[model samples]
Target: MFDNLVADFERPCALDIKLCRYYHGQCEDEHKRKKLEQKSNNSTSLSLGFRICGMQVYHPETGKLEKYNKYFGMSINDNQAVEVLRTFFGNSSNTNLHNISNTVRNIHTAILNQTDFVFLSISLFFFYDCKKTDVTPSIQKTDIDDQNVQAGFKVRLIDFEKAIASSDNKIHQLPQRIKDNINYGMVNLANIIDSFVIEK
Candidate 1:
């Protein structure tokens, strides 16, 4: 029973970004691990610490919704990740930028505070309203809302089936490599978002 995150938006643009450079778990079968590694290496996940798993954005100019599949995500290189994010956030207005920046900052803070769990194969899901009226030409930095769903933009971390918690007695301690991978992903994502906001 999961709640619809984008139910409130009229025209919601959604993006699924898979975090961490590694996707395989230590306990997985050797064959499956290799397959996951190959998939990660073939996508932006290997080089960028993140990959666009999927996206659906409403293009106002075309009055049509554009859907990007996992194949499109896997084909893109590190150099193209920024442009892909730009498309997701939309270049026509600053509203999305403001909201996304705030969301990223919140995610960063949450990541910093998280110490007992190591998330594996998780994704950051971003959604924002794409209606023309939702676009705001200018917004003061001070007016940027701190809430996750401010201005109809929101981001949430999902896909936690592989997450390892320190409280699990079977796993006496979480491995450092797992922790490092998540930190690496978050840091790289923050840098990417920072660059995108700065460029806009």
Candidate 2:
């Protein structure tokens, strides 16, 4: 019953990135904690603070939509994350790096403004039009009024079932891991997006 986010786009491409270094939040079971830890360590979530969970990309050349499962995401290393983003952003002449940069900046700013909140097992959902004709060149001349949806692309934070609000005194009092915070993930994500934008 949920609304389709990419309904407007002729060819939509989407990427789901799990955020934060730690996925489990204060699990009482020791075995479960170790399992979650191992899962995070094996994926880019431990090293990069974020891991690609899944993706659906439309390849114009092949004229088909390609699907990538969690296994493909788990196989990617820190260095390959940038290339993955590049593929998501596309390399068409109509691709706008500034739009991507602005999108990252907006997400970073939103993260910065959110204080005293611990987000666990959450994800970032990125979607855009894969068709070159639907890609807008830049933010300046876009007919769409929403700046967040520039270039027919949008990024949103999703999956809050495991999120811990500041009101949770227990979590606030607990010792925080180095990269367990949402800010850590956002910073790493911004850096990765910047790297891709600069290289382009």
Candidate 3:
């Protein structure tokens, strides 16, 4: 199902590399398409390709294939992904509701816009600095502007063995099956976001 989503979103000409080349003819459908890709060489958009179901199609932007490095996608489904996120964020104060909602909405929007490849499973990474509770002397006012504290979030879609190539169509309505799965995934995600409670 995820494969179908990705196929619908990505243009054949957009992917940076035809990851099928790495399969050495072992991959079924995706591998066959590599032949068609050979006829054209205009695609240059850097793409991570697909990696689910133990199948890997990795293409680094640096043009160096790092087979040794771990690929990012985890094998969890939508429900599990939501659970993991809830556990990480723990409980939040009502004041943080807006931020939590915005985070979910942003994720949903990004997924909807990504028509290139279906993501079998998605992974979330939370990065933040340790809270500095110890009181420190405040430096006197200076001309230098300080960089904001660093905490970032990222989403990774993995798994593409079932991926199929399709045309990109942002304006057109998707088939019912695809729409159903997307809606289901979003609902689960929303439930997780709603679970956050304002810490008293």
Candidate 4:
């Protein structure tokens, strides 16, 4: 239920809700049409020259080869056959290929976006220190600024190691949001430290 909510929110606005609902399995016939939509999204936007399910017709974008009666009404011939095999064989999935890929892409994009907050935090910290120091520090061990910089660095590093080890499912079964927030925060923090770190 939570995944459904987040997945809905994750989609960029302006995309048709009806279309999204249709794809996300909100309707009664969703299961039946799942394969068709999977084919559509995975391949790319369809053109007028394209054919619908169970019909042997050429798609303008995909040039050559008519879609046969299968996953997307397409045989997936030649090199495409290899790709199709890989997609299905590698996953042991019952869901259509498009849905599978969509889920993965969504997770990936979410994790990446979550990390952006980390960079923002680091950049803000850098500017704060720069204002006091009146200049940027060099990123080296010999160069140091302010008091106990090394202690701060060490504490931050320990915190980092703890965070990563804790976030893993093995050590701690963390919620996705928590994992995302931590990872994003850590990445940005690392970036900021790298910008003007010194080993004084």
Clash pairs (backbone) in predicted model 2: none
lDDT for 183 (candidate 2): 58
- For every candidate in turn, the CA RMSD to the true structure comes to 4.0, 3.6, 15.6, 21.2
lDDT of 4 by residue, 1-200 (tens): 01221132221111000001012222367666787466434531121112112222222233343323434523332244333323212312222223323332333344355532221011011001111212222223431211122111101111111234333444244334433333332332233223222211
Q: Which ranges of candidate 1 are over 4 A from the true structure? A: 92-99, 135-146, 169-175
1-200 per-residue lDDT for model 2 (tens digits): 24888888788899988876766567899999988788888988878878888888888878688788888888888777767777776654423555665665665576556776656656778777777465555454322223444566666667756666767866756556732555567677766666666665
lDDT of 2 at 48: 81
Prediction 2 TM-score vs. true? 0.80
Question: In model 2, where is the ten-residue run with the lowest total lDDT?
Answer: 140-149
lDDT of 1: 0.69
Screening candidate 4 with a backbone cut-off below 3 angstroms (N, C-alpha, C), the clashing residue pairs are 67-73, 68-73, 68-74, 118-188, 140-199, 141-199
Q: Worst lDDT window (10 residues) for model 1?
A: 137-146
The candidate with the higher lDDT, 1 or 4, is 1
Per-residue lDDT of candidate 3, residues 26-67 (tens digit): 336875668534322221101122111221122323322222
Give stretches of model 4 more than 4 Å off: 1-136, 141-169, 186-200
Q: State TM-scores per candidate.
A: 0.80, 0.80, 0.35, 0.17
Model 3 spans with C-alpha error above 4 angstroms:
1-87, 114-120, 130-165, 168-182, 198-200
lDDT of 3: 0.32
lDDT of candidates 1 onward, in order: 0.69, 0.69, 0.32, 0.26
